[model samples]
Target chain A: MKKILRTHILLFLLFALLLPSCMNEPVMPPNTNEGNFEALWKIIDTRYCYLDYKNINWDSIHDVYKTRLATDTTEFEFFDLLGDMLAELKDGHVNLSSNFDRSRYWNWYTDYPSNFSGSLISSSRYLGKDYRVAGGFMYQKIANDSIGYIYYGSFSDGFSDTNMWYIMNYFIDCKGLIIDVRDNGGGSLESAEALASYFFKNDTVTGYIRHKIGDGHSDFSSPQEIVTKANKKIQWQRPLIVLSNRLSYSATNDFINRIKASPNALVIGDQTGGGGGLPFSSELPNGWSIRFSASPMFDRDMQHTEWGIQPDIIDSLKVADVERGYDTIIEKAIKIINQSN
Target chain B: MKKAGFLILIIFFNVSVYSQTRNADTYLLSNVANTFGFGAISVLDPYLSPLQYNGIGLKYDNDNLRFLDTEKLNLSRQSKFTITAAEALNPAFTSLMMLVGANYQYGMYYHFQPISDLKVLAGGSCDVDFAVKYLPRNTNNPVNMDMSTNLNISAMAFYKLKLLKRDVQLQLSLQSPLLGCMFVPQTGASYYELFLLGNLTDAFHFSSLHNKRGFQSRLLLHVPFKRSNWHVGFDFNMLKYSANGAVYKKDDFGLVVGTTFDMISFSGRKNLPPSNFKSITE
Candidate 1:
């Protein structure tokens, strides 16, 4: 009996010792200029959500960038090279971070018309000193107190349901409400969803989002439905006008995509600068952090929103009008609201 | 196929113990030990980040060992409980992963005195374990949870000797899981889908010796002083698993200190001891 136990125990130990040999782990490249370059390139090639969707020739870009890499390249020069490679994707949401600088691609907004004039919005003709601020929204009556205009510049700021209740009461008598999201470079998606909830009349299918499921470029999970439910107590049943420009991006783009479905909503002004992809963070072997788009979002029609979304009514701001103390886009929005009312 | 073969071998080794005679009616004493450990730990949770993190680990353990009610004192039962926590940072010093885990085990072991100073115990155990790894960096997937129940095999050795006219005891114990079921979500699955959208699909997985491997070994030295025994030991643990093309790992090596004591009680499951067995709690 004892011999049997001994033999079993010996055999068990032998099996336990052999189990580790089965471990299969990817071999991480050594930390060098070439190694960091490969790591950064692979992270984008495998995980970035918009590569195939945007029709980017990533392999060609990689070939062009590889020739610029030198063994003695300084860290700063290496960062610049990688930043240039990322720019080929033409995405504002992609960035590379180091102690010295953060690299970004601004052509999404920079190459377009600046349809918004900050100085004009703050003038007495519009949201002057009387404009009250609540929940990151700057509000006052415009068009001779006939219309309500609110300038919300960022989604990073948070507000509560109580704030929405009070804001609704303030706009109760206006002909319509204008939400100007120009020059807003996106912050939190939840904030965007919350603000959109007030405009939705009922539970609505706003859009869809897909997450990367594997390392392959086209590998993604089934599109999950993004539903925007109405805020029962603070519903905005009045005519809603959402303003956009070349700089309206990221979460702002998402908000525009959702609120556009409202029965009483009209999107006006320039096409929104689009950054519809949600970014996730990663790092290279050299310890520099890489932020890339890891999830893709779509509109109700399953249309890709990576490029700017078209306004139902297109309007552009001419510097000649700003100089003449007349905000033409606001004038057009007021004209439309008055006609609708 | 390879995993199924190893699982059958483990089950065969454990099932042979019940083939012995069913005449187990002898009352016996139980020894209980409580230990606390603290040491350095390293973690690599690829779902959280590509970088590895290093930090300190803390664990607490309670063990109860007692011979079963048998005619001969050759079979013993053991119950153990352990809890561990660790917080670590990525190599870039930009991210942090906080982890907490707990486990409980119960098993029966066979004792064999191969030599005058050497006693070896081998057995199989059934255990349940749960753990959570939290990384605040990810926007959509912030936390990953692990829950599993396992069948395990364990072995222990005890050597008693004299040095400098003093009697001392040395012990080595090892345990590993052979098969179980585990929760392994997709590599980058969104928590928003699982929690907010309430879509829970393809998260639970059947784990075997091939995909999941773990082992723990503890060595202790007991010193007799003032008619009581106090022990200091080192514990080493390693665990690695894969599912949905993602691999996760956790490793710990720590030092522990504890004391041993004997206990006896008149319970429904335990037989009443005769005059030969002493009960301190009686």
Candidate 2:
């Protein structure tokens, strides 16, 4: 009996020691010559922590790639296959690099650079105090003729009531204002509100927030803060012209959408960046993080701003206009504003 | 009977002498080389109640322990050192261990441009020699290289507690090496300094100083295997990063579950208890 007990103890100890080694998975060197497509697939299979591809049809993407790999001979074909796959993901983080002529694609795609020589201003140093040459937050001085001009680079940050106070104070006396959110990639809605509030004096209907529920959707209007103090200083009544381009996005798009609904506002320039939603972050298993849109947004009139916001005046710029040093969009806006006056 | 007693006495004496000679504890306390390699005497001391093997028993000396003394002992140590010091004063007092580790890492800094737009916008800008351009009519271009070496020294300390006996460990680590400079060309300057220190093992082993970018803080919850020296855990980190002067600061968190194997062990000669076997036999 004693001998049996001792044998059992020894066996248990041996098993305990060997079990850990047996459980550990063997580490193998990665196959480098598996081709780019195979390598990418393997990486996603092994490294990607997320099980769900956000309801995206990954199998279809794989099937397309497999079909391409079977028959496609050209390198450009492979590149297009990868590009189409990435586009299906709809994730900004996922991208592929290929050796291809970029200038060919550049020539095919239309570029819109809004040519408006103007200064930018903010009420507080938080937004920016200095009047930069172009595409930076700057303060605008409203002239006695009730005309206001403000140039902004991007509207992604530094937008607050305090920061917008300077522009508001300047435009208090002006009848009309030119808000150049042309190249603004979009920022916070609070800054947009500061700009939007100037047009909509009544706090009753500001904007709306759209969110995704479990099965359906939901929408909520922004709360109103009554402006008790009357403008004893400067007061003007004229139409406002908001300058924009394809780069204008997020809060910038929201601003355009809201102002377009108003009776006294006009949107001028090309389409916007087509980003109109609240952003959210998600964690993947492979320790890679992704920030994406969580919910789709809409204006007061239940209009979605997803496929780029259309402007009132489709004042698109051309290369010929650039060569001639003519800002046709701004000139047209100025002309319209003058004609209205 | 007499012969057996004498044999026992001799065996005990020999074993004691051998054990004394093989004592790692003495070397750990007195040797300067061991101190530099591992750490000070306080760190080397055993924490848990030592288990008895055969006739010999090993026990931790807890009477002379002090925080300041441990800190002083660790002053001279440098490079790749792990100190796990725990304190539990009373029954009501919660047990806590402060774990700190440091390691020297060497790796390359890679700048990945996702799109070609960034490259065209950044690379097209050229530099002209102001002195020659304004005065002389010669066109001389200066050599320019965009890559640079980033040397960083990072140190972090965390307080860990065993939530359940060997099952879970909850830790909150303070971010460190918070300040470091990257040497890059003036034109291609971007703040890519965000680092998320994951696990204690990962922080010590795989973490590189140059790759410490795109995450400001991290929180880790380790789920350890019961009765096994292996753990598979999850991690979440917050990242604040920017590119092309566009700040994209968000709660960039991630989850990683990996297993760790503890392979380190201490080996030493056996110690024998004192005995008067010779006299008793006689």
Candidate 3:
């Protein structure tokens, strides 16, 4: 019996020792143009989260794009071809980056009215010379001091709760506040959620998210709830206006989605630029990296927010007003905050 | 009755081993060794990238060994701790992945001597390992952590001989993990939604022999010297597991150089050192 046991033990040890040698190394394509094309296609075919959601015929698209490649295509030509094919997804978050250039699909906002004027917003009529700044927020009392106006240009810029405390204290005597997020292209989702939490009355299930679980386009795990807990130390109680435009995107879109659910909050201006899918990146055989939407985020109703969110009040920048150093959207926001007061 | 007889036979064997050895050899010393190794490593974590990465690794290990029961010379214990770090790049040299890890293991072995020149030991061990892998270029999935605790079966053999007018020992040992519990988040879940937002459900799973297998083995030749014994050998490690729809692989082999020395600790009983055994502390 002891001999039998010893033999089994020795066999197990031999098996363990041999397994690493027997296992296959990870297989990847070579670094040719065709190899890179195949690698990029497979990465998107297996990992991109929105193929089935968007009803995109990726395999058919592959056939279409492959035919466009020439026998002697230049490096720039190949880059352009890849960029054009990616534009088919119409995602602003997706990009193909290399040492020379980056390809971006800008139609998500470029097709809409340029409702934002950088010069006009920073003019004497708004966010004037003495406008107080806290982190990413540029604020001053407007509408004859009855309303507080804050222009937050980028979600990428980090802000602390202490900054929020000071901003709230400065607006303590005001009737309402206007948060202009007109051209705030998104950055960190944590920043967006943190900014939204100041307005939440309690811990709220702000949204749901689904992650890819398999190679199949529709293979996704069950929705995971995203809860935005109210800042236990402080909460916004008065009327809050979230102003957005076609340039507000990604994390900015998420910020508006969470805050719009607050009973005391209203979204105004043009519909937001949508970039609701979470982006993940991978590499091609030639070493160029590709960013694509790999996770889909949704509102509390489980509805996709990729097409941008509608506003409670739609307004646009009138060119005539911009010539006079005034922002029509800001004036409209002032009127609404005045009425709410 | 047969089971009771078997248990008695084991106890008798253990006691008889002690009676056969001299008291000076059984009751007075412990062995400790420190080893450092450098070699190439190959890693393939599908969650990090589809391509396998190959690069250099550095490791440092410390082992403490002693008799578990002084009177029972056949029973012994070993405690080991190790730290390792590696950096690897993709085939195109466009991306880099870095991994740093630490491991600890403790076990006991029952010895067997079929011949006067050789000794064999079989034992069980428990170990814990923690590691982190980072890919600087991958967005939203830049980092993945590895945390696991495992129970393992281990064995070793020692052969004593005379070479070049000096006594030398050749030793071989293997440790294989059988069962473990590990943490591997669902593939494709962004860190923003999982960790920052505090969603930890379904992130841990039980890993068994079918899903996880690995072994750490070393073969060394120890040469006696005046102050301490110096050894040189090969150190190899291989670990791979399937979890959360992702496969993680790591294999490495390196040259190891180290020294082994014996230690003695007394509880103020004033035990005198045995003849030919010098104590520098004294």
The 10-residue segment of model 1 chain B with minimum total lDDT is B14-23
Best by DockQ: 3
What DockQ values do the models have?
0.30, 0.02, 0.42
Q: How well is each residue in A1-341 modelled by candidate 1, as lDDT tens digits?
A: 56775697678666665665467765555678888789889889988999898899889888999999998888899899999999888999889887788899999888888989999999998999889989889989998888999899999988889887888788889989999999998888888999999988798998898878888889988888889888888888888899999899999999999989888899999999998888877777666777788888899998888887899999998778899887778888899999997
lDDT of each: 0.82, 0.38, 0.83
The alpha-carbon deviation from the true structure for residue A305 of candidate 2, after best TM-score superposition, in angstroms, is 1.5
| lDDT tens digits, residue span B1-282, model 1 | 854454454443444343232234533557888898998888876666676778888999999998764465877878899998998877667667898999998876877688788898877788889988887765555677878888887889999988678898899898888788888777556666556655556677788787898887899988888978788999987788888887777788999999888876664433455556676876
Off by over 4 Å in 3: A1-13, A21-26, B1-29, B264-282
Off by over 4 Å in 2: A1-59, A66-84, A89-136, A140-146, A171-173, A204-238, A283-286, A318-325, B1-282
Candidate 3 per-residue lDDT, tens place, A1-341, comes to: 55764696689678888765544444678877777778888888888888877889999989999999885998889988888888888899789887778999999899999788888878877777999999999999887778888999898899999999999999999988889999999888889889888888888988898888888999887898888888888788888898999889999999988987877889989999989899888787777888888889999999888879998999988889888877898888778777876
- Candidate 2 per-residue lDDT, tens place, A1-341, comes to 44663474356335433322322221222322124455455333322222132454555667777766744356566556555654554433233432232111111013545434332123221123544333235545434345666776665555544455555565666656777787676775555655566565444343444322221112222221212122233222478888888767767886787677556789998877655545432212211222334344565555556556888888876557645655567556667887886
Model 2 chain A poorest ten-residue lDDT run? A101-110
Candidate with the larger DockQ of 1 and 3: 3
- Candidate 3 lDDT tens digits, B1-282: 854454344322322232322255666467899988889898887766777788999999899888766676767777899999999987778788999999998777778776787787777777889989899888788888888988787788888999899999998888887777888877677878778766665577797776787888898999999888999999888988877666778889999989999887554445555667666776
Q: Best candidate per lDDT, number?
A: 3
> Count of backbone clashes for each model?
0, 13, 0
